[model samples]
Target: MLDDATKAKWYRIVFDLKKQFGKKPDMNGLIFLIGVRELGQMREFAKHEKMDLMHIATCKLLSYEGYYKFEHIDEEGWPHYSLVQKPPFTDLMSQENRLRKLIVDYYEDNGLFEDMDQA
Candidate 1:
């Protein structure tokens, strides 16, 4: 289970994103949005392309923990990463929490929570 503070921050992020995008997004949606941002492109993605975007976002997030590292952006504009080490989180719950914490950290690092913190 998520602790109170973490849950609160997560909700704050959700609330902020809803206001910005005009709808609430689940965790996967947040990942997709992050992928869109990291890709540095603003266009509709195909179904498979959407999957690739989520992969890109996952790699970028895991890169924060030394599990992966950015290699280069491809000619097609997709960013690639290489595995530096094995991830420690194995089970589903642990993986979920890991991603959640990373998402929270990402939002906080990008200053997305500044106004939300005061509200």
Candidate 2:
């Protein structure tokens, strides 16, 4: 479990990233920001969230918008995302991103994502 300080740090990071980038962030971006170094781990997280499609589509949209560049790093064809300029929050989108990440994490920890996957 994450301690209070760690959670606060995550909140601040998400807040900053959102301030720099306008669009809502997806799972990959959040994972990347939290210092996840492996694309497979991120893919697992996506699989857990049932957000694989949403995450992939969001990455494509962000790439087209010139916010970042994405590369495929998985043998199963999952894309590894790298940011170009990072995100700019400065608005409600930042909070939204934070909320999204939190929700995803909650679902993951509660096995909701895992249960859905097995169903």
Candidate 3:
């Protein structure tokens, strides 16, 4: 469980990223952004490809929890993950909490918060 200070810090980080991007990104949007960054291919995506990107992000996040496993990147440069176990959350709030933890874990793991002074 996250302590109060840690939760506040995450909220601040999310808010700051929202400000930086000049929009209030919802959970899905944040995941998409994270997915795009993970994709490492800065280019336009097709309208139908957004869901695929989000799936990629979801897989990436869930992998840390042992629900997925990272496989090799394909020739197209997209990363693939295989299911290792079922997702840990079921209900709406629980799912949201899990995603929040995943987001914070992503930043922390990648040192994305090391220079987060603006928040």
Candidate 4:
């Protein structure tokens, strides 16, 4: 399980992403930022940490939004990334602002921020 400090950092990243771009993020984008790992590997990591995949995905998306860079090896021995200079929060917002809004709305509807507020 992630420590409280880490969780707080993750939440801050998520909130900042929303504030900066006014949007939520895609799962694939999040997975890529988390390390470009395969789905099965991600699942395993989540299981090991006793966290849900959705939660992990959310945290990773936020991390990416907060400009946490990831490095992965491509076939050409070069690096690949979910974000290059910075996380593509603005680009994602442009591509699917409405969808992003809907996602944040759904999270609010589901009380995703209740715990944060309590803290």
Candidate 5:
């Protein structure tokens, strides 16, 4: 289970995202948004591309922890990464918590939070 602080940060993230985008985003949606931001392009992605975006988001998020390192961006503007180390977490809950914390970190790093006093 998420600790109280993590839960509060997660709630602020979702709330701010909804307030900005005019829709609530679940975990997958947040991942997708991160993928879009990383891609630096806003366009309709095909179903397969959507999956690829999520993969990119995963790699990018893990990269923050030094699990993955950015390799290069392809001619098509797709970023690639190499796995440096596998994630330390084994169980689903732990992995989710890690990702949640990473998401919060991402927002802070990007200065996306408007009123982070609550966070």
Candidate 6:
């Protein structure tokens, strides 16, 4: 379960990302944006490309918490991360909470949520 601080942080992240994008972005959408930012390309993502982008974002988020490890960026600039630890939560809701906590960690660790905290 996510702690109160994590839930609050997640709420702020959603608000901030929505403000940045000018619309409400769901978990997948926010992760896709993070993936595109990581990929260093903001261009339109095709349907197939979006899947890969979401995967990249998942890896990126997991890497921070030791569930994955960054390996290398491919020639096309796609990131590759090797699984380092099995995820503890397996159920859908638990998995979602874990991701939410990790996403909050992502924003906090990267200073992305600093602005949110100030306001």
Which sections of candidate 1 miss by over 4 Å? 1-4, 115-119
Locate the minimum summed-lDDT window of 10 residues in model 1. 110-119
Q: Which has the greatest TM-score?
A: 3
Better of 2 and 5 by lDDT: 5
Query: Which scores higher on lDDT, 1 or 2?
Result: 1
Note the residue pairs that clash in candidate 6: none
After superposition on all CA atoms, how large is the RMSD of candidate 1?
A: 2.5
lDDT tens digits by residue: candidate 4, 1-119: 34465445545647755665577644444334333222235334444433344434444444434543445645633333354344345565453543343344434554645655665
Off by over 4 Å in 4: 31-119
Candidate 2 local lDDT, 1-119, one digit each (tens): 45575465455555555766875555566545433322234544554444554555455445544675876667855666777886566566564544455544544454644555464
Flag regions of model 3 displaced more than 4 Å.
Answer: none
Question: What local distance difference test score does each model get?
Answer: 0.88, 0.53, 0.85, 0.44, 0.88, 0.84
TM-score of candidate 2 relative to the true fold: 0.34
TM-score of each: 0.83, 0.34, 0.90, 0.28, 0.85, 0.85
What local lDDT does model 5 show for residue 2? 79
Candidate 3 clashes between residue pairs 3 or more apart in a chain or in different chains: none
Of candidate 3, the 10-residue stretch with the lowest lDDT total is 110-119
TM-score of 1: 0.83
